[model samples]
Target: MHIKYTISVIFIVTLVIIEKENNIISKVSDKLSTQLTPILFGPSLSAPHNASADQHEDRLLENSTWSTQQSSSPASASGGQKHILLLATTRTGSSFVGEFFNQHGSNMFYLFEPLWHVERMLSVESGGTNASVAGPAYRDVLHQLFLCEFSLLESFIEPAPQDHVTASLFRRESSQSLCEDPVCTPFVRKGFERYHCRVRRCGPLNLTLAAQSCKQKEHHAIKSVRVRQLETLRPLAEDPRLDMKFIQLVRDPRAVLASRMVAFSSKYKIWKRWAVGEDLPVDEDEVRKLKGNCDNIRMSAEIGLKQPPWLRGRYMLVRYEDIARFPMHKATEMYSFIGIPFSATVEEWIQHNTQASKEVSGVYSTQKNSSEQVEKWRFNIPFKLVQLVQQVCGPTMTLFGYKFAENKDMLMNKSVSLIEERTFL
Candidate 1:
């Protein structure tokens, strides 16, 4: 009877121990699930809390530790060590390039037309007292606006909680059934919340915060379409603290003319219908003349050559054709040239983001009268037009590797006979 009782006791004890271990594992798994769900779904964590209080507390602690790690680690903090500034004319793929950078986890702050503000200031400063009655007041208002915008953008990036989750996931992934830890949850949630809040607070100031925070580990990337003009960038480049590198992007004149026509036609229609009385359509000949002027490209090249040899290497000339045909390779080369480590994530991001669109086709004549399109100037223009361009811009074009067609008959016959009559003159 005593042996029977001992055997029964031993069986019961074994059963109880096994049950206890199972419960402990179940609790750990539940806690882990709570912590990791947010990361897996990415902004989709909406489940009701079912974990024990202890588990919740543990998750918060894990999160705090992860946050600390992200903040301390240079790689997690700053993405890279270069500030990239993209300079290009309208419809020249500046935005596309900026989007590419943004995908690479680079914080790309965009200024659609920063030059408009500069022009407004210049008009007021130059006109002085003779300026319009509203000029001085407008200038003061613009000054305040510019100051606020610049201040806001100065410190844009920050360390976030979700960054921890991403970092943790990046650190390890396994199939042996691991549960989320409570300690990691709070930090991820907090980081995500902060990021959302910053994005909502748009403008230069908010951008600055995000940028500065990210800069703690990575470099800064800026894309402002308005900085296309050389005069606009000169002052910025002169700033001692702003170590700006320029990437001047250009496209073939034929393509640019087509894009420009679309842009101008839209703008002209808007102005005619809303801001001003009806006006005649833009002269296709005049548009062609203006587009053919390679002044901006020449200026960019001059700037590149004029820089100290050290800085010359910093300026890269990106042709739009090269970007469209070989985005990944070009992007990698660009990042390398700028001394930033190329992230495979960034390459993936660009591929996912820049699926070719209709606008990228560089075709503006289809919707309009194809026969009357501005790009057809190559056919309509007399030989004199090509001769004029060659005479004035041939040397610069040659320096930039643009080969002039040897067939003088092909170019000379299309030259503008009434070149002096063109408005661009």
Candidate 2:
């Protein structure tokens, strides 16, 4: 009996030792598999090899860490949604980028320039940008909008379209959605139907219900030119409830200056529409205009540099140059950062929309001649004006890493390369 007990105990001990060895072997095998995967595979068969492609790849690699990453599978990404704001100025391609999002967002609702109401309602001009009285008031209205509360959209305590949510900023998309059950006359055709079933409007009014019903959406976005200051929205960014992210869209000021100077027609006075004050001169002197645009951009960048730690992944700077050059890549990056799938519909929209509509941009026509458009500012703006703009905007320009053209000839003779953007590091 003693011999039998000893044998049994020995068998149990042998089994325990075997199990321990197997656990170590399995762990080591996993370690080897993980370490070897990147090496044994070489780069996946899909990496690009062209000279320009290599350059672009390097650019993307450089900026990869800036785009905030969150778990992006359908379940986590889509269900949570986000409130995205394009913190941009007019003529910076804000409209173009906004349109891109509105079309492809699928589950997202976009507002063109909701703040136009804040100014008209409070009788403040130019978005009340300074932290003075109107500025704070504007922010309060903005806060309410971001929260998906549309009660504020109702006409002011007294009824008036001028002071209502349907004020100047409503734009075609919002205006059309106001068409009620019977559908209002002077209908808006810019996808007004998104609100039809849910809107149930009357006298083209009753949009409060539709706007408040935004809780079900995967995302809500607003594109505004009124917001030139980045820090102005700190309250929203810090709020865990707002779930907001911002994209700072910047364009070459030279290009921006040239685009504004293009002769305006009654049909496409897009630049004039950027005005804030009702009494602000329609045609400000070119020098003053250049200064204003440059200052706004310069300030935005400087402010971004001073952003607090909480905003690290929340604020992203996107260059029109990069978007123009690699629309697909940039779109994919932008959509991913916003927590949405860059679906095939987005791809198809891009393929068809590469030719920007002639109506908005005029001669520059969104035809998207890509690299060529970068040089247009050089050729379109007189050599003298270009030099002056460079002089007036030099420090601000350098702050954002925009290298000036050595000479007008260099604009064409020299190949232009864009410096990605200012790096906080």
lDDT of 2: 0.57
In model 1, where is the ten-residue run with the lowest total lDDT?
170-179
TM-score, cand. 1 = 0.46
lDDT of 2 at 190: 44
Error of 1 at 116 (Å): 5.0
lDDT scores in order: 0.44, 0.57
How accurate locally is residue 366 in candidate 2, as Cα lDDT from 0 to 100? 34
Residue 299 lDDT (model 1)? 70
TM-score of each: 0.46, 0.63
Clashes of each: 51, 2
Runs in model 1 deviating more than 4 A are 1-80, 106-149, 152-217, 228-240, 266-293, 306-310, 353-396, 403-425
